[model samples]
Target chain A: MEDVEAQTHLIGDSGEDPIISKIALAEVQRAIDSLPQEQREVLALVCGEDLTYREAAEVLNVPIGTVMSRLARARRRLVEMTAAA
Target chain B: MSELHLTDEILMAFADGELDQPVAAAVARVMAQDPAVARKIVEFQQSRRLTRSVFANNLAPDVPSELRAAISAKIEAYEAAVEGGEGKQAKETKSIWGGGMSPVRMALAASLAAVAVSAAYFIGQHSQSEVGRLAQLEHPRVLQELSRLESGRDAELPFGRLRVISTYRLPDNSLCREFRLQSTSTSTDAVACRTDGWRVTFALSDPAKGAEYVPSSGGDLLESYLDNLGAGNPLEGEAEAKALSETAR
Candidate 1:
């Protein structure tokens, strides 16, 4: 029952009030903590620090494609998690 | 319409300001009316703001001398390694190639399809010189996803910058802990295990931006740990604040 509710919460579409926003942020952070090392690092470079994808690629010293692919997977996972949470 | 099929990646890019002007404007139009898309955008924006706000305080203090000294030592070592002779040029060339055949050339190499796919692709790789284990611990799938789109807090987190910046404990009383993670380029979630369950605290701060985290003693970590620990209700206000201040400082 709790799991089902949690699943429903993940896909919720309500606008976030400040109180809800705080909970969502906490959930997001928790989601981030769960990612693969490389994926987490890339997410941080692009999302956390406000770097251009190109700049992030340069920083990580990996191919831009790798960055993109990893990011895609990472984002997909987040969306799923968000939907679930 | 098939032509208007926008992926979540593009929507996220638009939210993150990774879109070029024209592309961003195009997505903005779609988002204005699409409630689902709009919510995702709002979530992204809010998360970004909170991350910035949380870590912004760490920048207030001067770079601890210890951190600066350590980075300097590494830099000098790097210089010495390069100056040490014949092997230097090879290493430099390798780093450049490793950095990827130059971004300018790569951009020019792209086809139209590739250009269209730009926002969805484009992740930054780790530097070859980075040492230590790329330790990505296990987490619930939902939290795992958030790690991807979110980067570290600051600009250029210098290397080897760790300090026992704060501590926190949970009301559940499973555990209390303090950590000294690096101020730059390090994002980790730590959980001090409790008997009823584990009370975890995660930090995502970048020294480059001078971001300092506001201790979330009973915030997400306590609840999360409890969830994982398979016991009890979450912590609230006074206890939460007390646990955070007690452990983080």
Candidate 2:
């Protein structure tokens, strides 16, 4: 699990209530689980594993451009899903 | 120029630190005037953080027991092969030594062999001058560092620090260890699999160029190599530890 302090820092929010943070975490988890397997894998490697695009490409055996496109699509989907929720 | 059109690819690349400076600067300038684009970028960043938080566990999953067993078997097989080869070679050499020679002649022969071995070692080191200085080190150093990592000890060489990322058996059943070497300005990823000893099958380096150049992560390349070799999934934390411990023993 990610450090709550780091997550707050990334989102640039300090005054967020603990209750709201918990709800947001649940929403984010649900949105991610809803992603297709390929997109989820891309997101996991690029964001979670912290790999460079070139590195992700090499790992997945796809082109770097493909990794970029998949990541873009994945992020867009997550944003849309979270907003809908 | 027409209104700056920022494609999702460009925006994502900018957010991910994958874009070169001038292009990223242009994107930033455009986003300054467009709230929609700026919001999209923010969304991407937020999603990245969320995804990272959610999937952080994937990187260090528990190793399956079957994989651990496979590794142990592979190590035993490699050791057997090495012993068999050495036994045959030693027998031939022993016969040669036993074939009677005067004591003085035997002493002279031993001296010549020593000089020849030293000359060969120096020549081998010299031949690797075109490679990085770290790559020129004796093979024993690599084995020693690998052993240290197996035993959960810190190992460092003159050129850089070594990190054993993963260990697995290749499709051909060769035991392989993937490691990363981080130096002051360069990072090298290499895969060394056992034959007679650990032989480097793949190595790639990313030397620092300028302030903007980020070192490419070695894990991806190592994973890709494993994929191509049809090496199954990497041994997880416990499996890796068990395999390393067994090999060390």
Per-model CA lDDT versus the true structure: 0.38, 0.53
Clashes of 1: 37
Q: lDDT tens string, model 2, A20-71?
A: 5445556777776776766766675566545557766765668988988888
Model 1 CA lDDT for position B126: 26
**C-alpha-based local distance difference test score of model 2:** 0.53
User: Which regions in candidate 2 have their CA more than 4 angstroms from the true location?
Assistant: B1-4, B57-249
Clashing pairs in 2: none
Q: What lDDT, from 0 to 1, does candidate 1 have?
A: 0.38
